[model samples]
Target: MDTSGSLSITHLIFNASPLVQIVMLFLLGLSIASWTIIFSKSNSYKAARAKADEFEDKFWSGIDLNNLYQECIKKGQDLIGLEVIYSSGFKEFVRLINSGPADQEVVMDGTYRQMKVSQSREMENLESHLATLATIGSISPYIGLFGTVWGIMHAFIALAAVKNATLSMVAPPIAEALIATAMGLFAAIPAVMFYNRFVSKVEALENRYINFMDEFATILNRRLVRVRSEMNMKNNDVPQTNTQQPSSSYSQKSYNHPLGEEQHSPYSRARANTHSSPYQTPGVEGDRYRNTSRSPLQGQ
Candidate 1:
C-alpha cells in the first residue's frame, strides 16, 4: 500500500498513462476551440440581430428607397442582415428600369431572383462553424469513454500482479480515468447549446429577409405600373399644331373636303384664286367675276 505520492490534480494528470494523457490533451484542445468559436459566433449573431432591427425600422419608417439604396451602396460590402437582400434586389430593379421600363412581372421576377441569391449567401455565412460544433458534441463522449476504458484496463492488470490489493493503489488510477469523462462533458455542453441557439437565430434572420424582399418587390412593381401609365398617356396624345408635317399626313387626310391635300391649306388658297366660286350668287361682285373667268367654251 504505497500511497506516498500526492493525489493532487497535477499529480493525477502527470501520473496518468500515456494514452489517457493523450485523450485529455485532445479534449482540452477541443474545449479551447469550441469556446473560442462560441464567443466569436455569439458576438457575430448579436451584432447581426441589432443591425437587422435597425434597418427594418428605417425601411418601414417610409424612408425613400432610393436614398436607402444610396446608403447601402456607401456601406459597400459592410451591408448586413436585410440590407444585403434589399440592396441586391433594388440594384437589379434599377438596372432593369434604366435599361428600359420592362413589364412589371419581368422586373419583379428579376429582383426577386437576385434577392433569393443574396439570401442564400447570407444563410451560408450565418451557418458557418455550426457543423463543427455538432461534430464535437456528438463524438466527444465516446472518445472520453475510450480513454477511460484503456486506463482502467491498465489499472486492473497492475492489481492482478500485486499479491495484496489495497484501496490506495486502486483509487489514484480510477480517479485519473474518470477525469477524462468530465473533460468530455465540459467540451460538449456549450457546443450543443450554442449550436441550437445559433440555428434559431439564423432562421429568424432568413424569415425577415424574405418578408422584406417581398414587400420591396411589391413597391417596385407599383412604381413600374405608375411610370408606364404616364409614358403611355404622353405617347397617345394628339398634337395641337404642326398637322401638315409628313407624319401627320395620313391622319389629316382621313377628314377632307374631297379636294385633296390642297383643301387643307396652301393648295386650297391656290384653287380659290384660279376658279370661279361655285357658291356665288348673281349679285354685282359675283356677276363681274363670272363674266371675266367663265370658260372659253361658254357664249358671252
Candidate 2:
C-alpha cells in the first residue's frame, strides 16, 4: 500500500506476513550461499584445470622422473593436483627401492597405493561444499512453494472478513504469494546447473589422475627393467672362468714326484745302489776259480 496504490517488490516483501517474510529471508540466504559457492568453485575449478594442464605438459615433456620429483619437492606445500599424486608415488618408490631388496611387485603396489591415497585427498578437496549446494538446489523451490501457499491462504482468509473482493484487494496478496515461487526457482536453477557442471569437472579430473597413475606406473616399471638389463649386461661383460694348469704341466708332475727336476722326490723308486759286496758264498760262485776256499789252498 503506497500513496498511489502502486505495489512494488519492496512493498510486497515488507507487507508480507511474518511467515512469508521468513521464507523469503530463508530463500535469500540460500540464494546467497549458492552464489558464493558458485563463485568460489568457479575459481577453484579454473585453478585446478590450469594446474592439471601445466602438470601434464611438464610430465610429458620428456623430463627425467627424478628431476620432476625433485622439482615437486621444492614446490613443497604449494604442490597441487597431479603434482601431489606424482610426488607421493615417487617418494614411496624411492623409499622402497632404497630400503633394500624387496619384491618388485610389492614395491610397485605400494607406490600405486600411495598415489591413490593422494588422489583421494585431492578429490576430497574438490568435492567439498558440493553436497550443500545440491541440498539448497533441491529444497529451495519447495520451501518457496510452501511460503506462497501460506500467503495465498492468508490472503483468502482476509478476503472472507471483507464481504467485497476487488482486483486491488485480490491481486496484491496473490502476487506476493507468487513471488515466493519465483524466488524459489531463482535460487534453485543456478544451483542445480552449477552443481552438475562441477560434478562433471570433478569426474574428469578423477579420470585424468587415474590414467596418469597407470601411465606413470608403467614408466617406472620400464625403468626398473632397463636398469636390471644394464646390470645383466655389465655382469656378462666380466670374465668368470676359473684358472687351470696346462696339460704339459700335469705331464711334468707326478704323485709326490716332479720328473726332470733336480730335487729328490718322495716317490723315487728307481734309485741305484752306491755300495757292492765283494764276499760271495761258495755255491753262489757257480764253479768259478775264485770259488776255491782258503782251506783248499792250505791242503795243497
Candidate 3:
C-alpha cells in the first residue's frame, strides 16, 4: 500500500535553495530557446525540402526559361532552392537583353553567372538559422556544467557556515545542485540532435544543388552545340548551293545571318569556357554557395 512517488515540481521548487532556484530559472530559459529553435528549424527545413523537390521536377520537365521564371515569380522569389536558380538565370537574361545588343556568348555567360549567384543566395538563406542551433548545441553543456559547479559550491559554503551540520542538513541542497546538472544535460541533448540533423540536411541540399547545376549546364551546352552546328552547316553549305540559287537571294540570305549563327558560335566557346563553372567565381552569392558545397567545380 506504499503510494509514495518521486517529489513533485512544486515540492522541489519550494524546498530548493536560492542558488538552485536561480540555476533552475536559467535552465528553463535555455530549454525554451532550444525548443523554439527546434520548432522553427523544423519548419524551415521542411519548406526547403518541399521547394527543392517541386523546383527540380519543374526544371527537368523541359519548361522554357520564361515559363519557369513566371511560375517562380508567382510563388514569390523566396521559394527555396530551385527558385534561386531560376531567378538568377532570368535576371541575367533580362540584364543582357536590356544592356543593349549582346551576342549569344555574352547572354549565356551573364545568365550562367546569375544562376550561380542565386543558387548561393538561396543556400545562405537555407543555412541562416542553423548557426543559432549550433550555438545552443555547442555551449549549452558548458553552461549547464557552470550551473552545476555553482550549485555544488553553494552547498559546500552552506555546510561550512553551519556549526553542527548533519547529513540531513547537507543532502537536500546537494541533491538540488544535481538537478542543475541534469537540467543542463536535458537542454544539451536536443540541441545536439538538432545540430546533427541540420548538418545532414544541409549536406543533402548541397549535393542536390550541385547535381542540378551540372545537369542544367549540360542541357545548355547541348543547346549551344546544336545552334553552332546549324550555323556552321549553313556557312559551309553556301558555296555548294550558290549555283542552284539566284546570286541576289544567296547574298541576301548571307547578309541577314542569324546573330550568333555565323560568328562566335556558342558551342566551342562554351566548351572552352567549361574550365570554370559559374559557381567557382568570387561574388557575394558565389562565396555563400561554394562554402556550403566545399567542393571545387571540376569543369569538363
Candidate 4:
C-alpha cells in the first residue's frame, strides 16, 4: 500500500497529462505561497498584539501625556498599533491647543479624527495580505476540481479507445485524475482554516484598538475641557481695564462740571482738573470727600 501510494504521488505526476501536470504545479505554487503568507501573518499579528498590550499597559499606568508623546516621537515610525493611535490623538490635541485656545468640542473632534485615521492605517497594516490568503482558500479547490474534471474527461476518452474495458484498464487513469481533486483540497483546507483564524485575531485586535481610542479620547477631552476652563478663568481674571477706562472718564467729566462756578459747584472742577484721575471711589465715603472738597471751594 505504501509502495502504491508512493507510485501514485511520484510516478503518476511524471506520467500525468500536460494539463494535469500544469494544474498540479499551479496548486503546489499556491500552497507554497499560502503557507508563506500564513507564517508571515502569524508573526506580524503576534508582534502587533504584543506591542498593543505593552502600550496599553503603559498608557493606563498613569504616565504623563507629554512624556508618552515624547517617547513615541523618539520611537518614530517603529511605533505601531495602539501606540500610534495614542500618539496621533495626543499630538493633535497638543497642536490644536498650542495654536491657540480652541473649543473643547473642536479639540476633541480633531483628536478623534486623527486617531481614527491612525486606527484605519494600523488595521490595514494588520490585515495586509489577508486577501491573498482568502483568494487562495476560495479558488484553490475550484482550480483543483477543474483539473480533476479535465483529467477525468481525458481518462474516459482513453477508455473509449479500448476494445474492452476492465478495472485494470480503468483504475490507474481514474486514480491519477482524482489526484487533482486531492491536491486542491490539500492546498485549500489549511488556507481556509488559517484565514479564518487570522481574521478573528485581526478583529480582536481591532476591537481592542477601538476601545482604547474611545477611552483615550475621553481622557484627552477631559484634559482639553480643563485647559479651556483654566484659560477662561485667566481671561476673566485679567480685569477689562480698557472697558472700565471709558466709564471712569465719563464719571470724571460729570464730576468736573466745567460750566459750574467753583463756590456753587457740589464738587470742585479744579480738583478734578488737577487730579485728571480715571479711577474714582464710590459710595458714602466718596460723597463725604466731595462735600469736604466743596466746603474748601466754597470758603475760597
Candidate with top lDDT is 2
Task: Report clash pairs, candidate 2.
Answer: none
lDDT of 2 by residue, 2-41 (tens): 8987888889888888999999999999999999999999
Report per-prediction Cα RMSD to one decimal: 25.7, 35.6, 9.7, 22.2
Where's the lowest-lDDT run of ten residues in candidate 2? 272-281
Better of 3 and 4 by TM-score: 4
Q: List where candidate 4 sits over 4 angstroms from the true fold.
A: 1-7, 234-300
Residues 26-55, model 1: lDDT tens digits: 999999989988898888878877786677
- All candidates' TM-scores? 0.76, 0.78, 0.70, 0.76
Ranking by lDDT: 2, 1, 4, 3
* Tens digits of lDDT, candidate 3, 1-300: 014744455665657777777877877788789889889877877787777666655554445555566677887735677677866665565555445435667767777877788778777977776787777767767776776677778889878978999976776666676777778788878988987877777777777776667555555545545545554555566677577765442232222212223334333233334443212222353334434533332110
Candidate 3, position 192, lDDT: 84
Q: How would you encode candidate 4's per-residue C-alpha lDDT over 1-300 as one tens digit per residue?
A: 155543446777777889998999999999999999999998888888778657755665555566667789999879988889987887776666544434668877998999999999999998899999999999999999988888889999999988989977777676777888898999999999999988888877887778777766766665444434543454456567755553322233222222222322213323333333211222343334333322211121
Angstrom error at residue 17, model 3? 4.0
In model 1, state the lDDT of residue 73.
91
Candidate 3's C-alpha lDDT?
A: 0.63
- Model 1's lDDT to the true fold? 0.71
Candidates ranked, most accurate by TM-score first: 2, 1, 4, 3
- In candidate 3, position 204 carries an lDDT of 75
Please report the TM-score between candidate 1 and the true structure: 0.76
- Candidates in order have lDDT scores of 0.71, 0.73, 0.63, 0.70
Tell me the lDDT of model 1 at 16.
Answer: 97
